[model samples]
Target chain A: MAGGGNLVVTVSPHIKSPETTGSIMRLVLLGLLPATLWACVLFGISGIAVIAISVITALFCEVTWHNLRDGKGTGRTWFALVSSLVVPIGVSAAGLGRAAPAAAIALMSAFILSEAGISRQGERRHSFDGSAAVTGLLLALVLPPLVPWWIPFVGAFIAIWLGKEIFGGLGYNVFNPALVARAILVLSWPAHLTAGWFRSLGIDATSKATPLMLAKTGAAADLTAYYAPLLLNNPGGCIGEVSAFLLLVGGAMLLWKRVITWEIPVTYLGAMAVASVLMGVDPVFHLLAGGAVLGAVFMATDYVTSPVSSRGKIVFGIMCGAITMLLRVYSKAPEGVTSAILFMNMVTPLIDRSTMPRPFGVVRAGRGVRK
Target chain B: MRVRLIDLTRGLVQENPLLRLMIGLCSALAVSVKVENTIFMGLAVIFVLTLSNIVISAIRPVTPDNIRIPIFLVVVSSFVTIVDLVLKAYFPEVYARLGVWIPLIVVNCIILGRAEAFAYRNGILASTLDGLGMGAGYTLVLIVMGIVRELLGTGSITMMGVTLISLGTGFQAPTFMITFPGAFLTFGLIMGALNKAQSALAERAARRATGSAGRPTPVGGV
Candidate 1:
């Protein structure tokens, strides 16, 4: 106001989009609902229980942290109160005994309260938006059904705090929070993450090797058993990732909603199929097994962590697929979807930078100079 | 006397050599994997820092300005050698674990930086207090990092053939906490916490001084 002198401005296309982060996040959650419901039905109450605990913990942590940091109350306190009431039911549903989940919740609550002392206003417009819930659900989907329920609680905390908050939350994160949490959990407790795949529900459900694990050992009979089950979501693998058909349906919804473009999912699966065939592995099995479908459609397409342009997205996909196939075939781990997407997440900015489109009606400086 | 007391207390928090000044980080990050190793490392740093500061400050008047760096190095290296040999003789296991780090302390920036910045200009008493303060601060950080890394990485704390705590047999410790990247992450988080606490304290002090009638604000509080 003191020195109002020149008022020079430029540029014409100044229309703003109507979409807010909360709205987009809501769409993502809606798109994920189909596959999530299928996973719950297939895995039974235990599956729903896993998802419920994760979503509740994530929302509670986000709201509590934001409230304490900014000294303001959140609407989601009601949600936390409700979650606390349901903790017993959820724990019982998941077949976990009284001690572990309770202990984890107690520890997590203490940690959140302590951290809230230094909490500044976080980057999100509101705390209880659907992003944290989306992250929670995605992380749970990638986990084995019989994993200690506390693993989800711990993973949600780490995913929200270390992965998102420390990086200034939501839009600023470099890696997908769910993938980051899963990667850390996998590295930290390899035994729990890789083992304990439940084949079904109730007394009939058995702890069996995942199809990817059996395929890793080159067992033809085991591979044959995987043919229909892998696609139909009847196999013993990570909770939500076994349902390739359902995931595809969910991915189609995301594409129809315009929440995600087809560039990433198509290129990723295409590259994966080509690579798997070249590596002498069954392409269909590679596409359907492990977390490949879940990650390529859901994780790799994360707007905050993936490239912005279509070209960059394609490159990001190819790189993700190539590294995933490489790790699956050559590395000791039977699945590499999480690490591959996380690895590509780290490179998204670089791809975007290199693939930035030139402005319209602008002459190249070097050419102009020559002329 | 008051000023000298401040010098002694400053390094404990205000000018912490590890978290605040961020000097000698190589040793802090590398050797803070075990509580036992941290204890040995801390003791070694204290012995070397205090003695080196005394020797440097006592000789500062007679020492030529043109070659103060060489004189400082000589003093530091002498103390480091004594620590090295004494550890090798008495605590061979720790000595072996510490290995090159014992000798590497001679080049630690905290030692050389203090000699040039504080000891070279200050009196012997002030220099000695600064060294003690800095050494205490460094030791405190090393011990804290050691505890965090050891507990999380191994699921238990064992020192000098004794177990202080254990997470039981069923607990699967995150081995990443003891790795190199884990060290960096731990150090960064600790540093951020220290910064936040210091700033918060400063802000409270400022608020009090501004609100009240006759209180003097803390020196360099902001």
Candidate 2:
């Protein structure tokens, strides 16, 4: 070594935490599983299909982007990319029934080859960690379960490539990748994204407006009837957002595990409750509806996008709640959680800068410590 | 003549008005939604730009330094007015689609920027070439953007009621590609791609300069 091992010239924050990104991501995934399983149970095979497609596509994009960026073995990378995509496209174009089987085989083979490639001594890590999976699952959770097979595939691409990778990959992204994908999907295909909800498990399980949508037009569901449904199942909203009780349970698990701090979620829900009441609406219903619980417990507390300071987290959470309520009450859109978290994500840097804690024993430069 | 050719070709790539110079973007963003609109808009800009450059260059000696901006504006406005009137009279449909932008071209920074930077001191020939080159570069970007936005946003490209290419009925076009944010996104992506290509070209040139052995062991190439 140039300066010997003792004189290690490394970057700042000399101490290190035991938690690797992989470990933390694993915990995060574990936390999200309850709500995700509930979502699958509620939305059925179509829901599981959406989740699988999104996760697979997300993992694909993550690896593909990394390989392309590395600039070595680019020919092989391009071949892999084209071959994986062409098989499906070609299959469809040749009047073969469904491209799904071809796509699955091609993608699985690509993943296996990539896994072997990364297992070598010095290859890029590329989706070895579970962050991409978490993003994919989060995006799937936000999407309505009944969208065409292609929707989640496209969304996973957007979430990974546009939302995360384009912003210098995971840690530097300003917004939650899942939320960005969901919001863009909504904006791009309102007819599909808005109307694909599978609500209230029964005869007419799909195509009905969400309770929040109906409430916007002044036909509030019976409070007691909705209370149990919204908490347990079949609140007729986004896939993972159907069971507020399950989401809450997951949120509590994450909090208890100390994976996420209480500042953002607590303040967010508290503020939402207060604001909803002020606006003459039921806070409990508002909290259960749309993406409120999912966003507060998961999206807003994102380690990279959210503020570092506890005070900043509180401020961010309150602003998110206030904006969520304001958008729900005033804006044309029935759901506000996605936009609220996204908007606050943009403001996170300012919150962090302003909320920096003063160093111990330090006084203002203009004033003396004695004074 | 060689220098003059360089001046003529430079703006078409290296010193492109919209991408490189980054001047006159508002009009481009506004009018680059349809392939036909871009064509008409591009033509109008080239006409106004070249004539204004010629006029400004011709009058450069007489024009006072104290109020050069105002002089440039007057010269630019006269040319823009001609375009405005001509388009409104002949291509009324394009004029309507490009509404406020035609008038807005008078205030476009590219004209004044070139007048101040290049045309104010250059010969009429050089200024004329620069103007044409810059205008062509701008139009190229506009056409590319129009094709991209229209093709993606609508699943097809149509120019003057003639369909060029359609992605068929199954294609679910993302409407985001047609919106204002889409304009910024497209512009950014194009710029990023150009940067990537330019860097690659520079790297190849460096490799050639280093020697035909092609090992590229010079500096950090290894």
Candidate 3:
């Protein structure tokens, strides 16, 4: 397995594993499936449409970039295209009740045409695997369903371009691409991103404030009503963030598969719970509201952006939760999960540096040298 | 004469103050939200820079080197006061928008930098040309940035109370483009584009000089 890598001559007792980047990414995608599908089911056609556009656009960008650069496409690129195209259409048609299927078909067709136009200049094949699709899916899940169609298109492009590629792609990215895109979009159009929230299940399809917003305004009197529907996945919030239960389920799948460890998420939620209690709010309600669960499970534990050492990861999570609560309680913005996670992403390297373990049998010299 | 012309033209691109030399950015970024304000600011800079350059160059031969900086400050402040009074009297709207940035021009690094770096060593004519060139370059960038910020931030471009272009009712403008961070983003992106374009031109020249079938680098590789 290590044969393909640059072999650095080191001390003996070498170990190797068959796990590759593509394999890990596929598992991550599998873990995300439940929450994504639930979001589509609750938000209906528009939710699916957003996810479809994002995923296809992401894959299209990756493949087009490679094709233009290398003049050939890889096997994984074709697989990514087919999967990004087929999965969203199938999920939307099956889950979305009584909405026109034509919209999905038209979107997919247009995307295909775009992909064809992009790849026509090259004769070579490229590989996309599932990383871009995962980023696209995650980005869609965090966005409000009431946003205009073009928002996702623009967001996905920026996510892939600025968030991922500009940092030299995949393992090199400092921030989670989806969160970066969301942050940029939110900053660019606060009215569109933060104001327009659709009720879940398309039940009135009317725009309403998320529970976090209500909490911020102190308008949510019935705290029980706010916490009751957390499991039902029918609340006023971003498409996937509404369902705390489903997000937990997906997170558990990742934990069970060992795609992600429990350190970051556990510490993150624990710290958030403590902060909520300290702030005189119900801990469980705080845990369930906004994007706390989604961000704790998905964004904070990102392999590239999160701290590598276990101790560092715990500190990172605690800081993220604390900053998130501080912003929620004291800042003007109603929610702070995205910004909090991004802030932590920036500090992960510093955390890792501080927490690095000392080498065996090594000792430091005395405090000061003689002048 | 050709060397002097190069000195005059170099500031336009080869050594642009804001984008390349990176001086006088405090006023440039702050007052670039409106085209009218930027024009006034640019003209003020040109006036102050040119006059200060001429004064510094004329005094360099007679004055002691130790007190040159204080002398430069006095000359620059005198010219800045003139600009201040003129704008306050004639273009109060632009002056009002510009506010403290106009007075802060006395401390603007470009004016003093030209005095200390170029004017103190060169003749009066050459120093004046250098100041005009640098000021023109700064003004060009200000106008370009003003157009971008105003057009995107407010969906319309207005100059002296006249609407030059309006995106109309259907367009949704991003207000971030006129904010402080937006100014940095605009400057950074334009600078990056200029760097890339210049490097591409250099590579093409290198290829021409080589006169061989060298492997061609792809466009926009960076």
Top-DockQ structure, candidate number? 2
Residue A70 Cα positional deviation in candidate 1, in Å, after optimal superposition:
1.3
Q: Which stretches of candidate 3 lie over 4 Å from their true place?
A: A1-16, A65-124, A201-207, A361-371, B1-3, B62-64, B213-222
Ranking 1 against 2 by lDDT, winner: 2
Per-residue lDDT value at B3 in model 3: 47
Report, for every candidate in turn, its global Cα lDDT versus the true structure.
Answer: 0.82, 0.84, 0.81
The TM-score measured for candidate 1 stands at 0.80
| C-alpha lDDT (0 to 100) for residue A229 of candidate 3 | 72
What is the C-alpha lDDT profile of model 1 across B1-222, one tens digit per residue? 345598899889889998878899999999988999999999899889989999999997799999989989999999999999999999998899999999999999989988888888888899889989999999999999999999999999998889999987756799878888679879988887777677777767877868955645444322
* Each prediction's RMSD to truth: 6.9, 3.7, 6.2
Docking class of 1: medium
Which lDDT value does model 1 have at B68?
Answer: 89
lDDT of 1 by residue, A1-371 (tens): 44666863558767768887788888888877887888888778667767866776786567666665666554544455456546644566576666546644664465445444554565434435688889988888888887877778778878888788777778999989998888888878888888867776432223577777777886545454566777776568888875788888888988998989999999999999999999988898889888888889989999999999999999999999999999999999889888899888988889999998889988766778463
Per-candidate interface C-alpha RMSD?
0.9, 0.6, 1.4
Chain B of model 1: TM-score? 0.92
lDDT by residue for model 2 (B1-222), tens: 235688789888788888888889998887888889999889988998899898988998899999999989988999889999999999898889889999999889888888899899898999999899988999999999999999998899987788999999868899988888778878888887787687777768877887755654332110
Give one digit per residue, the lDDT tens place, for model 2 in A5-50: 6767878898999988888888888888998888888788878888
Q: CAPRI verdict on model 3?
A: medium
Model 2 bad stretches (over 4 Å): A1-15, A93-102, A105-127, A203-207, A221-224, A365-371, B1-3, B211-222
